[model samples]
Target: MKTFKKATDPNILKHVNALDNGEITTVSLKHIFHHGSSKYPNLFRRLDVTEENLRTQELASGTSFAYDVMGVNGTGFKYEKDNAVEEFRNISMNELKSSKLDWRDIGKWLPAIKNWGTLINLAKMTYNAYIEMGQEDWYDLGEEYSTNNTFGWEEDGIRGYVFASSDNKTLIISIKGTSMGFGAGPTVPRDKENDNLLFSCCCAKVDRTWTPVCDCYKGGYSCDKTCLQDSVDGESLYYGITLNLVNSIYHEYPNSHIWLTGHSLGGALSSLMGLTYNLPVVAFESPGERKAASLLHLPHPPAIPWDKMNIYHFGHTADPIYMGSCNGFSSSCYIGGYAMETKCHAGIACTFDTVSKLKWSVNIKRHRIQEIIDNILKVWWNLFKLFPDCKNDDECEDCGLWEYIE
Candidate 1:
C-alpha cells in the first residue's frame, strides 16, 4: 500500500477555489489497469506520484486540487481469467456466479457520499481519466487546472486508472469511454461492439436492415432472452473485463473506500461495477444501463432499499445520450454505428434541467465530459447556488416496445 504526503502548491492554490473555505486536497495515481492485446492482456502497473508527475490547479466550485500526471509503464500483477472465475464461483456458492451480484453482501461496501463537493471531485477525476488519451495538458492550455496522466495500452481492449487519496483511505477507479469520432482508433471496433452489446436492446437490432451485434434478435420486436444473457456474459467483452478489474481492486484495497466514476460508456461500466460489488459510483452523461444490468442478471436483492445504494448518475437535459433521446437511424448515435437504445438508468439521478431552466437545446455535442464540466456542472451551482436533488428512477422503463422471449 504506497501512500503520498500532502504537499500543497501555492500556484495551484491560487488557481483553485477554496472548497467550503478549506484547502482542496488531491488524489494520487496509484495504479493503471489494462486488458487485451498484450503478452499479459490483463496487466496492472503500480506507480507513485512525484513532483514532475503531480499537477495542481483550479477545478469545480471554489475548490482546487492536485492530481498525478505520469506516463504509464511497469508490470505489477497479471490477472488470469480461469483462476479468477474459479475463485469467484467458489466464493459465490449458491449465489448467481455468472452475475456476481451476491445480494447477501449488499450495502456492505457503500461509499461515503458526503456532499456535492465529493461528486464534483469525482467528476473531475473522471475527466482526468477521459482526457488522458489526447495527451494534451488542459492546464497548460489555460483551460482550467486539469491533469493529464498518460496510461498507454494497446488500441484494443479496456483500460482504466486507479486514484487514491493522500491518506490512502479512498480509491477512485476511473474508466475510459468510447473514443470513436472523425477517424477510427484501434479500439473503435471493440468499443462499438461493447456499446452495442451493453446499451442496446436485443443486440442493437434497430431494424431488419441493421446487423445485430449478437444473434439475440429473434424477429420483429422479439429477442431471445437466453441468447441476450449469454452475449452479455461473454468473458472477452468489456463488461466481463470490468468485473475482473473490480474484483482485483477489491482484493488489493480491502480497507480503502473504493468509488467508480466515468463519462459516457465509461460511466455506464462504472455503474455496472457499482452494482456488482455494492460500491459507490458517480457516472456522468451516461446512457441508461439498467436494462443491461437486467440482462446480466444482477441481483436486485429485495431486502435492499433503492436509497441505500450509492449509485448516482449526473447529467443534464441537453445531452441526447443522457436524456435517452438519441436513437433511430437519423440520430447521431445510430449514425455513428452506436445503438444507444437504453435510457433507464439504475439508482438516483442527480440531473440538471439545462434544457428547461437554462434554455439549452438538446444536442449530441453536449455529451462531452468537458462540456458537462464547463457548461453544466461547473456553472449550474455557481449560478443557481443549489443542486438538483438526486432521486431514484425505479419506475423508469427501457425497451418498452421490445419483447424478450424466454
Candidate 2:
C-alpha cells in the first residue's frame, strides 16, 4: 500500500552530508548530447506530423496519506487520480519507438493523476540537478544540495542525475537546464541552440538583426515545415540524447517506478521524454513544448485525452518564459539570446497566481529555478494551505501567427 503522510521540510545540509558520506545512493550521468557543426548524425527518425486537440475529462481530486519513501515523511500534498489510468502508465521503449511509426494511432501514455507531494519532491530533485558543488552550494541551497563525489553538477555540462529510493522501489532522473544568466558556462551556446530549436516559432527569428538558428526560416513569417521537423530530430540534439539516456535508465530499472523532473529547458525536455515513454513527469517553469512535439510528431493517446496524462507543469505566473510573454526585441529574453516564445505546455498545468495572489510583477529573473524553489515552494504551506488547481491547457495554442509551408 502506498501511503504518503505529511512530509517534513527537507534538510539540505543533512542530505548533502549523507550523499558525501555514501549514506544516500546516487548516480551521475554524463553524456555528450551534441556534436560539432559537421559531426551530427545524418540519419533522422521522423514521426508523421499531425494536428490534434482531443478534449477529455479530468480525474477527481483527493488527498494522499503522507508516506515515507525518500526519508521525508508528513501529510502528503493534495492529489487527483483515476485508478483506470494506471494500466497505461508504463510502456517499453521498443514499443514506443515502433508505435511512433504511426504515432497518431497510439494508445495511452500517462495516468490521469496529480499529487502535490510528488510534484514537490520531483522539483527538489530537479533543483539538486543544478547544484554546481563547490561553486554555488551556498547560493541559497536548501532541502537539496550538491555532493561533489556522487551528485556534483556542472554549470555548463549536459548531464543528468539518477536517484534511487532506499528501498529501490522508485527511481528519479533529473535533467539539468540551461546554465546561463544565473551562471554563464561552457554549454551556453549549445544550450541556446536547443532552446531556440525547441521553443521558437521559427528558428529564434525575432527581428532583422537576429541570426536565425536554422535555415528553416523562409523570410517573413514563413518557415519550411520539413526543414523545421528535421532540425528537431537531429541525433545531436538534447532531446534525442536525453531519450537514449532515459531508455537506458528504464532498461536498468524495468520494474521500478521511474520519474522525470527538471526546470526550464530541462523541464521542457522532461515533459517531452514523458510524452514519448509514458513516464510520470513534474516539470517546473517549462516553456510550451507543444510546437516541438507537433514538429517531432510524437505519439498521443487517442482515447484517454490529455488532462489524464501524468505529466504536470508546476510554475508561477511571474515568469515570462513560462508564461510565454518573454519575447520581442526589447524583452530580456531577446537581449539574452533566448527565444522562449512557446507558452502552451503539454499535459496538466498547475500554475500559482503569483501576480494576483502574491502581488508579484512578471519578470524574467523569476524564471530561475532557485527563485521558485527558495522563495516559493519551501514556504508554500505558510503562503497557501493547498496546491493550486491543476487543469488541461485546452485553450492554449502556440505559434498561431506563423505559417509553416511544405
Candidate 3:
C-alpha cells in the first residue's frame, strides 16, 4: 500500500523553496504525499494510490480541487508535442528571412483610412502648428527630433526617423510619428488632450494593413474619405522608410534583441512591422488593426511563434479610443483568460492597465522605462532558474506565458 503524508507540514515550503532554488534534483511522490498528509490528511489520503489510478481519479473528480492541485491531464502540464522553437528556426532561416523580402507589401494591404473625420481635424492641427512655427522653427524642430537619431531619406520618397541608444542594442523606427498627423507643435501633449489624437493617427497605419483597400468613401461615415486618400499615399512613403530602417538594423546588429514600438499612428505601423517582419513589438494603447488587416488576407497573430514577441498596452481607462466600435468591432469584447502557467502565442498580446489610479504615479512615470527593462530582466532570470532542468522535449519548455502568448 502506498503511504501518504500531510501537505501542510512545515517541510512543504522548504522542499518547494529548494525546488525553486535548484537545490534539489529529484523529488518523489512520497515526499509530496508525506508533506500533504501531515497537514491535510483528507487531501493527502487520495494520493495514497497508484499513479495511473490517481490520474484517473483526478480526471473523474471533475472538481476544481483536482485541477488546482494537479494540472489538466492533456493540456496544462502535458509537454508540447510540436516543437515550435525548432520549427520557427527552420521557417525563420528560409521562409521568413529577415532580409530580402519587402515587408511593405503587407503594409500596402491595410485599410487606407479609418475614422477619417477625426484624422482630418488632426491634420489641421498639425498644419496650423507648421504655419505658426514658420520655416526656420520647423527646420529647428526637425533638427531637435533628429538629434535623438539620424534622419535618412528612403528610395520610396519617405524620410526616416531612426532612434538608437548609444549601445545600439535597441532601435525605434518611427515610420510615422506625431509629425505624420500634424507637422509641428505644440505637438499634441503626451497627456489626455492629445492622447486620443495620437491614437487616431496610429490607426492610419492599421488602416493601411487591415482596413479595406478601396478608394471610395461615402460621406456621413465617421471616416474622412479625403484624409483616407492622403493616408494611402502617406503609408506608401512610410513603408519605404521602415524597410530602410530594417535593413540598417540587419547590418548594424546581427545578433541583438530588436523591438519596434509606437504610439497611436506609430503603433499601427509598428504592428505592421511585427506582423510582416516577425519582429517583436511593445505597442502602447493601440487600436485593433488586425481586424482590418485580416480583411486584406493578412495573417493573424497565431501565425507567429509566441516566444519572440510581446505587445504591452498601457491604456488610460478613460481614453476615448477604447470606448467606441471602431473598425466595425466593439472594444469591450472579452477573449478568454489563460492559466498563469500557460505559454504565450506568437501574435499580439494586449495588456490593459488604468494609468491614473496607480499609487506610485510619480515614481512610476519617472522610472517607467527602467521598470519595463527590469521586468524583462526578471522574466529572463526566472526562465533560466525554472528551465535549467528542462530538456528539449520537456513539456511547456518556456518558463511562463506572456500576455501575447495567452
Candidate 4:
C-alpha cells in the first residue's frame, strides 16, 4: 500500500513498462530506483528493487509477466538438500512420459496420486513426531484417522468422516476432494465403550461443471446473483457441519473447543467456516476464498477480524493452485522470491527450486503443488520450533535471521 514517489521516475518507469510489456530485465529492475535524482531525491531510498520483490510481483501478476528474481536465502540450496525438487521433477517427467491419456485419465490419476502422497507424507511426519516425543505408547492417530470411519456423517448433500483423540478435547475434520460436502458431530460411545475424541471428515460434491461463482463469472466488480448463491451454499454447508459438531458436543460434554482443518479447496472452505462461525482453523494448502467470503459478508452476523482468525495457509513455492489469480483474496502477504531469506534456509532453497521446477515443468498442477509444498514446509519448520524443544520457548523474539541475506 506504500506509494512510491518515483512512480514516474524514468528508471522505475522503464521497469514497470518493461514488466507490462513482458520484457523486464534484471538490469532494468536493479537500476529502477536510480532514475530521478534531484527532482526525486528520496526515490532511490523508497524504491530499491530486489530479486525476491520481483518474484513476489510476478506472482501477484500471475506469472504472466517475466521477471528475474534471485533467491538470496539459502532456499535455493535447501531444495536440493531436501530432495523435494528432485522428487517433483521426477513426478513431472513421469507424468509427461505417461501423458498418452486424455483429461479424463488425468483427472482420475491426479486424485489418486494426491491422496496417496498425502497419506504417505502425513504418516512420515506423524512417525517423526512420535520419535521426537519419545513416546512408545502414543496412539498412531494419523493411521487411525486414515483408516477408521468410527465418526462419520452425511446430511444436506454433505458427507464427512472424523478423527478424534483419546481425550475428546481435540478434533480434526478433513474434507476430501473438491466438494462442499463434509461430516459432522461428536463420536457416540459404541456399546459401553467411552469415546475419547470427536472428529469429522467431509467433502463437497465436486460439481466439475460448477464453475466458481465470482466477479469473473459476470465480469463485474461485485458478486453477481449466481455467485452469491454459490458462496452462500458453500458457506452454509460449512457452517452446518461445524454447528452440528458443536451442538452434539454441547448435548454431551457441554464444554469443548473445536479445531478445524482441511487441504486445498477444503482449506478454503474451512477458513470460510472459521471466519464466519468464530471457529479456529488450521488449514493446509488452502486457496483463498476471500473474494467469495468478502462478497457474501457474514450472512447475518459479521465474521471475526483478520487478527482473530487462526487460519494457517500451508503451501509450497511451486504450487500454482495456491498461487491464484493475483487480483483475488489470496494476494495478501503472499511471499515469493523476495521473502525467501537464507536464515530461513528451507524457504530460500524451496523457493529457488520451485522457480526452477516451474520453469522446467510448465505444467500447472506440478508447479502449484511444488510451490505449496515449499511454503508449507517453511511454515511447518517454524511452527515445529514453537513447541518446547532443546532451545528456548521465548515469546516475541525476532526470528528474521535471514532478512539481511537477501
- Return the top candidate by TM-score: 1
Q: Which one is best on lDDT? A: 1
The digit string of per-residue lDDT tens for model 2 on 1-406 reads: 2222232345432222222221222222221121122122221111111111001100111211112223221111111232222222222122322121221222222211233334455666676566432222222111232222423133232546565544445566778887777555656777888899999999899888889889999988899987988898777687777776677667767876676778999889998887767677778999888778767766444433574456888898888888888433337566478888888888888888889888889888898887877777766656776566678876877887788897
Tell me the TM-score of each prediction against the true structure.
0.75, 0.69, 0.35, 0.36
| Selected candidate, larger TM-score, 1 vs 3 | 1
Residue range 135-250, candidate 1, lDDT tens digits: 23221211222123434445656667788776766678988888767653567778888889888878888876678898888787899887888898777788887887778778
Give RMSD to native, each candidate: 9.7, 13.6, 24.0, 26.8
What is the model-wide C-alpha lDDT for candidate 1? 0.66
Quantify all predictions' global Cα lDDT against the true fold: 0.66, 0.61, 0.29, 0.28
lDDT of each residue in 119-219, candidate 4, tens digit only: 22322221111111111222221112321232221112221223333343333344322321122112111100100000000011112332232222332
Output the TM-score of candidate 1.
Answer: 0.75
lDDT of 2 at 51: 16
Runs in model 2 with CA error above 4 Å? 1-118, 132-157, 301-304, 327-332
Ranking of all candidate structures by their TM-score, best first = 1, 2, 4, 3
Please list the residue runs of candidate 3 whose C-alpha ends up more than 4 Å from where it truly belongs after superposition. 1-167, 172-176, 179-214, 218-237, 295-297, 305-308, 322-346, 349-406
CA deviation > 4 Å runs, candidate 1: 1-25, 37-51, 54-116, 131-153, 183-185, 301-303, 326-332
